[model samples]
Every structure is written in structure tokens, then in C-alpha cells.
Target: MRTALNLRLFLAAVIATAVALVATAVVLNFLFRLYFEDRLRDELETYLIQLSGNVAVTDSGEVEVGPLADPRFNNPLSGYYWQIEVAGADPVLSPSFWGAPMALERPEQPGVIRVQDINIGTEEPLAVAHWVILTGQDAAQRSLHLAVALDRTDLDVSVAGFRLNSTLWLAVLGAFLLIASAVQIRLGLRPLEKVRSEVNRVSRSPAGRLSDDYPTEVLPLVEEVNQLLDTNAATLERVRAGAGNLAHGLKTPLTILHGVERKLRKAGQDLLADELQTEIASIEHIVERELARHRDSGQSRQVCEVAPVVRRLSDALSQQPGSEQIRWSVEVDERLRAPFDEFDLTELVGNLLDNAMKWTDGRIVVRGALSGTVASLTVCDDGPGLSDAGHEIVLGRGRKADPERSGTGLGLSIADEMAQAHGCALTLDRSDMGGLSVMLAWEQAEAAPR
Candidate 1:
């Protein structure tokens, strides 16, 4: 199946949300890590400043460690350490170092601060160092380097936790947004769905029209469709009116010609009179064909129940002279519908039944049933069925199996035109009754090929 528009839009929204959330999580985590690194540097710099002020050179020319402010500096292997180095004396280390010598990079100049990573054999820490020139008792300047270190394990743990929490919350937010997008898409397009349903209804019923109660976005479209329908209806009406007027105007002249033919026959000029009658009959056939074409155009899109229409046509046909003698059997379900206008259905069936009545000796049957997307109909008669070549001839305009019949031979041709108009296939073949069988199969109007 083709994907629905709303579903495609919703999927795009979901994918976009997921990508945005992932990007947001990555950015937030990165920014937080930078902030944490700055905080670590500031803490290390503060410790380094305090250590510089506390350093001293004794009168014995030996370096001595003073009482430190931070308790972690006094603990063994506490992961926070301070070390002091002098240019001409041994380096002094804090108790927290546990005698593990940290390789620290010296600062570039005096009173200048530097931050670097120091890795002992077992652990890595961030170190901040500063170099200072101190004046001893002899007024000699001694270069002192003070450095403070802190382990990065705690910062890493904090960042990992923040990242995990951010991902989970962002995933939840994305799901909520997907649900909201689905609802919004459906609500936004509900007006178009309404218009579709109403348009379908109008196609099935000629009297139906789309209402103006639509969203502003769809109002213009609905108005244009309604106006087009009105224009088509008016145009069809005018054409049919002209056809009807033409038929009426020709009928009087044909009647006068028939009178002239009758007079010639009474006056014993049968050969010329018969030739004139044949020509007049051909003219009448053309008029009937034109009228049938106009009648079919305005009735193609209507929907009607098959059984009622068949019964109504059968009842009307039975009132005619030869129709009463035939055994009429109709087998149609009441619910079996045909996608054809009621009048069109009557005309299509009437032509077939009228021809059957003309040729049948006793029995005629009309059967209708729907299967899948097709409506199947069969009209059978107990008459001398035509050969393959005759079938083609009878379906042609003004061709009859028997010239003795009163018709102008336009019945099947008109029926063929009606079938084509409604996207139906009509066929003639030998029947079970040892006679002619006419079959019509049409798809549902929506599925019909235009």
C-alpha cells in the first residue's frame, strides 16, 4: 500500500526530533565538560596560591613545609597534592602524595601560571603550577616552583551521570513531541477528509453538493468544485434540450413522408415508395442514435440498486403487446447496486429486453449479481441465437437479423454506446436456453477506467 501523507509527515517529524535531541545532548555534555575543567583549574590555582605564601627557607639553608590549610593535603594518597621545588635545594612534597613523585612541567617565567596534566605510575591528575622568586636572609633571590594537583576521576563520574540523565529525559521529551505531532497533523487535515467524503457522496447522488462549512484553507477549493458541477449540469441540460428540439422538429417531417409513402402505395407505385420508406427509416435511426447519446451523458455517474430498476423496467415492458406472452424471470438481489444512473440503467436494460422480446418464442430471463468490484448482469432469451459473424452485425448501427422486425436496428447499438459510457463491457453469445445471451460486466465507478 502507498504510504499515507500524515504518516509520512509524522515519521519525518519523529526522525528530526530524535536527531535534534541527540545533538542537544552532545552539545550540553560538551559545554558542561568545559565548565568542569575550568572549575578544576580554578580550584588548583587557588591551592597553588596558598602553597606559595606558606613556603619558607630556614636559617639552616634547608626548605621546610608549613601547616597546610586543606586537610586532604595532609592525608596520604588523598588524590589532592602539593609540591614545592627550589633552584638549589631538594624538592618538598605534601603528605597526600605518599612519596609518589609527580612529573610536573615548570612555568615559563616568574609569577606566571601554567596548567598541565601530571601522571604518576598509577594515577593521572590535573596540575596547576607557578614560579616565584623569593628573597632569603642573605638577600639572595631563590626561584621557587609551587604546583597543586587534583584527580580527574570525580569530574569524569559527574559528567557521565549528567550525560546519562540528559539522554533519558530528551528521549522522553521526543516521544511526547511525536505524539503531539500526530494529533496536530490529523486535526489539521480533518477538513480535507470531510471534503473527500462529501465529494464521494455527490458522485453517487446527482442531487448532492458540497456544503460551505469548511476550513478557510479549503473553502476556495470546495467553491470551485461546486461551481464546476453546476456548469456541467447546465451544459448537459442545454445540450439535451437542443437534442429534444431537433428530434421534435424532425418527427413532423418524417410523419408527412410516411403519409406520402402510404399514398404512393395506395396508388400502386410500391417499388419507389418502398425505397423512400427505407431512406426515411435510416434517417429515423440517426435521430435515435443522437438522442440516446445525449440521454446517456447526463446519467453516467449515478448509483442505483439493480434489482428494483430491473423489476420496474420489466413491469413497464410487460404492459406492451408481445412482452405479456413471454415468461419473465428476474433473479437479482435487492442490495446488488450498479454504479449507473437509474434512467441510464433503464435504457440499457430496456434495449436488450426489447430485442429479446422481439426474437423470443416464450421465455426471457434477467439475472444480476455483484462479484468483487464488478457488477455482472445477464439477459437471456429462448430464440434462434446468432452466429459469431451475426453478433458483430447486430451490434452495429442499423443492422438487424430480420428485416421483417419493426425496429430500425439501433437498439443494440444504443445499448453498446450506453455500456461504453459507463465503462461496461457488453457481450453476446449462445445461452443455456439454446438462444441468445447478453452479458454486461461493469466495475465500480471509482475503479472504472475513464
Candidate 2:
């Protein structure tokens, strides 16, 4: 499964802590068991020494037993026991054994100590043995073996309690360590979160750049990003300068062609003069359209207020020769702004409004509104509208819906280009004013109305 860096690190640390704690608990429990076994052997050795000091053998081979200091040795099957055996006599057993005998092993040689684990009937016990030689009356010698043993219950209980407590504490300690690791991971990655937010703001703001307030490890990356943005800005400026130079260079040839047309008319070649005039007009239209696009690219980006641009274009179109006979009206929110440069907005509105003034018979209306982050502009006229197919053809460059209309086909095409430059949708439909309606819709860049 996929996992984030912080979560993966946390899980790794927690698993490692859990495994280490578990291993520590196991090792400590094992060591405690070994220590407890050694303690049982030591206690058995002390009992062995006590029994040997008080034991005796008579000349007639009778075994004599004595009282021991520990009261546990006197109680039958009290989990404590002792036994003594001579060369060929019956074995002596502690009172703790009751009538049951312990199967304690003898030492191989005199004064040699032996330790083992054996079962007294069904119970397991630790057994330690010592061998010696005893002298009786007349200098006769007899062999003696002494041993002590106890059950494993007390040792088991002690080791079990130590393991339980150690595990509990270690587990609690592991939990705290995991929590600390989580906190450390969060603190370490906080700077990265800040960088992500700043990068988003840069994309949304035209003049925004990455901030330098970052850790040493991240500072180099931030500097590189800022450099890239600066380089891009310089490249766009050079491109715009080149386009402007080319446009001015072409205008000179167009001016010379106009002079030739006038000279041809003065030479009495009227037919050739008219043809050159039409060609010059066509070339001028192409130049104007290209210049409009160039301006769109060169203009500085800003929030273009819709109301002022619409009113200014409406007033300018009203002054045109044919437009004086028609009424012009504009309705737009004063606070509404589009995410476009001012010159681009002017070109888009001027082209559409100019076309409306040329076609409308009585009245022309321009309306604008803001809906959420989207802005919509509509221009309508009371003249005859186009069919669906005709509207489609009008959107194409150099294609006029009605050739009889006294205008070049560049108007609607230029407006369409501007809409596409701003990443907008331009569509045509019949208006309620019993005429053609053109609408433009685009997303706004600003958060507020202004």
C-alpha cells in the first residue's frame, strides 16, 4: 500500500520500539531465571553443611540424625529435603520427605560436591550432594553421602513476577517513544508545507514570487524557482518587441502601395486603380487584425473593469456614420472585473460593438454580469440574425455571413481571437431583441468583485 513519508517513518519507529522492548523483556526474564536457580543451589549447600556437622555413624552401623536450624526441613514434603547414605546401610531421609524417599545421587569421590535436578516421586527439585569419610571406634572407617534438595515452585514464582513487571514498564516506555517520534516528524516537515502554499500563491498572482525565508536545505531550490520566473519574463518582453518591429516594418510597404494606387489613378488607369484600392484595403484589414493580437500579447496583465470599457466602446461606436441613426445602450456592474489586460478587453468589446452598430436597424444593447468566478458579456442588435450554420461561418476568419453588408469579415473573427486569447468561450444565438446575440464567458481571476 502507498503511504506518506511521515506515516511510514512513524510506523517504522513504532515497530522497532515494540520489537526491541519485547526482546529486552525476554532476555531479562531468562537472566532472572538463571540467577534464581543459582540462589536455590546456594541455599541447598548451606543445608548440606548443617546436616554433615550433626550426622554420625555408630560402630554397629546404625545411622543417627540430628535437628536442623531450618524448620522447613522438619515438615514432611515441605518443598525442602535432605538425605544421607553410607557404604552399605539404608539411606537417611529428612523429615520433610515424610515416608517418601528422595532419589538424590551420591558424589563419585570423598569431599566432592555434586549438583543435579531430580524428581521426588512426581515433584521436580534441585539436589546438591557431598561425599565424605567418617571414622568410628577402633579406627574403622565408613563412607558417608549427604544431599539437600527443594521444589521449583518458589523460584518459578519469583521469575514470573519479575518478567510481568518488566514487560509492563517497557511497554509503557515504548508508547512514549512512539509519541515522541511522531512529534519530531511533524516538526521536521512543517517548512515543506509552507513552501507548498507559497507556490500556489505565486501561480495565482501576476507579480508574486517565491519567498527566501526558508531553511538552508530548501533555500537553494527557492532561489532556482525565482530565477526561472525572471528568465521567462525577460523572454516574453523580447518576443513582444520583435512582433512590434515586424508590424511597423510592414506598414511602410503598405504606405508605398497606397502611393502607387494614387499614381495609377492619375495616369487614367481607373480599372487598375480600383483593383489596387481593394487590395490595399484587404491588406490594411489583415494588418489591423494582426496588430490587435500583438497588442494582446504586449499588454501588462491586470483586472479589466467591464463597465467602463463597455461604455467607452458604446460611445465611440455611436459616433460612427451609420451608428448615428440607431440607439445604443450598455448595462454592466461597475465593480465587475475580468481577468484580462485592459487593451485586450477594449479590443474584444470594440469589435463586437462595432459589428452590432453596423448591422442593427433601430437599437443596440450591450449587457454584462458576474456569476461566481465567471463573467458574461452579451451584445445584441434588432437586425436580421444568422442561422446556426451562418453563425458558425461568421466565427471563421475572412468569412462574412452577408457579402452585401458594407464591412470586412475581420470584425467577428478578431473578437473570436481575443476570446480565445483570454481562454473564453464565444457563442452566437438569437436575442430577445429580435436580432443576433453574441455572448462571451470567462473565469475571473480576482476573489472579490473589484
TM-score on alpha carbons, each prediction: 0.85, 0.69
- lDDT tens readout by residue for model 1, 1-450: 899888899989988988899899999999999999999888888888888778877766677767778899888878888888877666788887775566666665777888876667775554455555464645655667787888887888999999999989998999899999999999988998999899888988877789999988899999999998898778878987898899899989999998998899999999989898888878988888888788777566678778888899888888887566788999975656676877778878888998889889899999987666777889999899899998998988778887777777888888887788777899999989988999988885333321
Candidate 2 residue runs with Cα over 4 Å from true position:
1-3, 31-68, 85-91, 98-145, 250-383, 403-426, 436-450
Question: Residue 29 deviation, candidate 1, in Å?
Answer: 0.9
Scored against the true structure, residue 74 in model 1 reaches a CA lDDT of: 84
Tell me the deviation in Å of residue 323 in model 1.
4.1
- The digit string of per-residue lDDT tens for model 2 on 64-126 reads 888999899889778888888877777888877765665555556677667777765565554
- Taking every candidate in turn, the Cα RMSD to the unseen true structure, in Å, is 4.2, 5.8
